[model samples]
Target: MAIISKLTIISILVISFALAFLAFYLISPLSKEQRKEQIGEIISQLINFVLFLWLAKILLNLQLFVQDPLAVLAYPSNSEAFYLATLFTGVLLFYKRRQKKITGVLLAHSFLQVFLAASFFYEFIQFVWRDNPFSFHYLIVFGVLLALFHLLQGRAKPQNQISIVLAVGAAGFFAINFMLPYLTLFGYIMEPWFLALLLAACFGLLIKDPQDEPHSETH
Candidate 1:
């Protein structure tokens, strides 16, 4: 039963991702060919990120891994592992952007849109269907974030828009965790340091010169 439940949750997450991808296709301003190319790149990056996340999880549980690699692989990743994986993936993306392999602006904008959509769908589906505990506050946060992004469309530059969304998300999560220390993000408690790191990265992007935005990157 536990295995079945975990499988169901994973299946639901995939559905949420699919719904987010559909939202991206319907709302993105890029041409079909450009969107296709961008999707390919995004999927590649996502795969890389997931790989890093899995590796981080294993590294976090090295003893368990040494004893039974399969058991370690099946364990759920903790918050520390999530943050560490995010740090590594962020660095990788930064390096790739510096090499001009990907446009920072487009990636940030498209990712924020997709992330917001996915968060909403995932939380809503879990709350509605899952027997496990759900955070109503978490659902509201993502719903509001998605609505805010939609409302700010065209009114703000793509870079500024992403920055704002990140800031709001960081603030929202901070508030949630502070007010309810028992609450966990998904299943892992998001520490203050992790939130601080997220804000630091968001602000780092904000300080970059607006002139550096690629010509292809547009609202």
Candidate 2:
């Protein structure tokens, strides 16, 4: 019974994630082939992040992991692990881009859309099914991000849109996290340092010339 319940939960989560990706793919403005490739890359990046997160969680508690591996594995990942995972993933992304496996603009655009879509869906599910009070705040937050990104698509340069959105999102998160002591998304409270790093990364990406990006949009 326990095994079956775990399997069911995993299956539901997979389906929900697939639906989120599908929603982004359907509404994307990129060409069909471009959209497909971008979504594929997004999935690959997400997998990389998850794998790093798992590894970081184990490493964060070396003593516990050495004593009781099973118990350590069963425990939830902490904020420090989350930050380490994000840092490792960011490094991996930089390496991939250097290898010409990733394009700056396309990755930025695709990732933002998929992130917002998945976040909104997760918050909606939490609000409706779990009656989480924080979920409503997150839903409104993500909705505003979606609307802001859409508004920027027309007014802002394609190269600048992602940086602008990322900056704004990080700032918003910082404010919310400061005001709400129990700030959490997907059961992990974000550390301020992570948001600060995101802002720094956004600034770094902002300086790149879009023309140099392989998948850069001229329009």
Question: Using alpha carbons, what is the TM-score of model 1?
Answer: 0.88
Q: How far off is residue 118 in model 1, in Å?
A: 0.2
Model 2 scores a TM of 0.86
Which tens-of-lDDT digit does each residue in 44-162 have in candidate 2?
A: 88888888988998998889899999987776678888889988988988887777677776687778877887787777777887677777877888888888888886577656778
lDDT of 1: 0.78
The residue pairs found clashing in candidate 1 are none
| Candidate topping lDDT | 1
Best by TM-score: 1
Tell me how many residue pairs clash in candidate 1.
Answer: 0
Model 2 C-alpha lDDT versus the unseen true structure: 0.75
Q: Over the stretch 91-133, how does candidate 1's per-residue lDDT look in tens digits?
A: 9988987887877787777787887898788888878877444
